[model samples]
Target: MSSTTMEASAALDGFHPITRQWFTEAFPEPTRAQTLAWPAIAAGRSTLLLAPTGSGKTLAAFLVAIDRIMFGLPEPTLSENKPGVRVLYISPLKALGVDVERNLRAPLAGVRAVAQREGVPFHEPQVGVRSGDTPAAERTRLNRQPPEILITTPESLYLILTSRSRDILRDVDTVIVDEIHSLVATKRGTHLFLSLERLERLRREDDPQRRPLQRIGLSATQRPLDEVARLLGGAEADANPEQPVRPRPVEIVEAGRSKQIAVTIEVPVEDMTQLAQPVVTGSAAGAPQPASIWPAIHPRLVELIRGHRSTMIFVNSRRLAERLAAAINELAEEELALAHHGSIAKDTRLVIEDRLKLGQLPAIVATSSMELGIDMGAVDLVVQIEAPPSIASGLQR
Candidate 1:
């Protein structure tokens, strides 16, 4: 099957058989978001898709990009081995980039299968992730040998645009900004805007004859669509007299109903009595506790660890994360408790993530590290020791 034929067949039915098989295997079925968003994306239109968490919005955005890259380009001859970066995927979190890489393998495999049947020298489109934790050797290699698709966080992208390797963005044909809502209200987004402008400047300089790179913005939630459109492209996006301005369409797919979540709240039984004891008793004045009550809150953490089979506990501070883990281990019956946060070594975190994915870890006490899109399989329960400051942070948990 030629790539062109594969795309045409999929276009008639909204998704290719291979892709549909992969999707069914990785996830149960395409959500409502995927159903509506796929066509607009397949048409090569710039799009802003809005849907709630756990709605498969990420897959919706990437499937189109993968299909286009697979089908839109001509089959490469034996001599064609190198292709510059074609897709620049900007994720808000480094963890999400890793998760996206895992999710993309299935689709890539599907493309390769089709290419092989056609007797084309199927070069698997190289996908690389760049982040703060990306090893020094990989970073250096990426500069010399750019991937067909590059996944990175905004901060990493900002650093790349400002660094000597800025030229890598020159041939970028598409830019997908994942989690745009997370960046839109902060200085990070402000900095990213300038970086996009810089990228546009570079694209103009390097490929003056080519059309501007297609911009696709992905978000779980956003309001005031006009502002986001301008943020993606400048004010001149709608009114570039020289070029025809066809604004990308935005689509929203709400989950039919909220999934029923099981939540449990734990409180200290023994410590409550001590806390109720007065600071001053007759002639003896008790030593004063710290003004902040986090220490007092520590004893209540054990119930959180033992309450669920697979759990993630969000802590406000890294020190507290370690301390709570240590405390939980001391109190836990099965010795399955482990601390996970940014302060922990990267190698250790990866191991913990693996264990959690396999359901080997009974309880993994973590800060925001486990949040975002790092797949730990389906967690039976999530315990928030403290209230998340914002709804967005809470959603990630």
Candidate 2:
């Protein structure tokens, strides 16, 4: 390898002896998205990684942040609190906020273990999640200890941007918005972009280097590449705040190439009219057919799950997710099936997520909650209860 290639390899190969080994062992080859995305991000550029559902986009964004932490965080005294937050991860869902930590466990642990063996103090990427579900005590404690990598929802991020402890984020150099397609077209995205600008303002106020925040957006679907790129990189600062706003530019990495997508839409093998009928009745039919129609398909759902090592059964809404999940739980009593939706209690949802990742559960009946690329290990199958709202949503799921 040339000198420059060797240097880039060393930097991107985890930036530490332990991390490099972890990368080699865990992923022998970088996915297309990671291959193109990492160098741009590491070079302090904003990027939008548009890849297929399981293309390792999350790792592409996270590994660079992890590298910075492993090699850059200052060593602190035992009594001192960890350093200021430098990477803020914004997930549209609260469930996903905590899921990022689970997704991060291996690289962080592996690299840290290697450092410990070599007597190096690795401290940069202490991660924490803050959301509505985050307890007051936990929130207070995190603010005091200030994790360098913070995973939070847009709402929680707004609170952080406006709260007294906002300074905890003043040093943040990177902001990762996962599942950007879910938010980019809505008011949530608007609020989030404003929050991004606010985050920029906070950093500009105190950072000695005065560097702009490096943004990495992971998306399943997006159109008009330049617009999405501009959206990824928020409005630029004005020499005068009242002047016309200029937006930052971004490098769009399109990894939506030919890949092996094995999707089979299955229906009942026989005696299926009952499964098609809406089981719940408030009107001619209670809610949508699929939500109310789950009873008839309960057997089939269970059978499909039994056939696969791990299955993510996608439904449309929280209501349907809960109802079908409950019915599936009863039908597949022997199988460890769990309900996952926005309405489910946070603790229960978290437990289900962990179970799915560990392969302890065969199936999880979920709504759009499972749509985002929050690692659940290798899912063998995906069964959507009904058609998704749009082609984009379907592609994402």
Clashes of each: 0, 0
Error of 2 at 169 (Å): 1.2
Question: Tens digit of lDDT per residue, candidate 2, span 365-386?
Answer: 8888778777766687888877
- The TM-score obtained by model 2 is 0.83
Compute each candidate's TM-score over C-alphas: 0.80, 0.83
TM-score of 1: 0.80
Q: What is the alpha-carbon lDDT of model 1 when measured against the actual structure?
A: 0.70
lDDT of each: 0.70, 0.79
Which residue runs does candidate 2 get wrong by more than 4 Å? 1-18, 73-82, 119-121, 206-209, 237-244, 265-295, 329-336
Candidate 1 wrongly placed segments (more than 4 Å): 1-29, 74-82, 117-121, 207-210, 221-230, 237-257, 263-286, 290-301
Best by TM-score: 2
Give model 1 RMSD, 1 decimal: 5.5
lDDT of 1 by residue, 256-342 (tens): 336576666655344555665545434455665424345555545556545666877777778877877777776654566688877
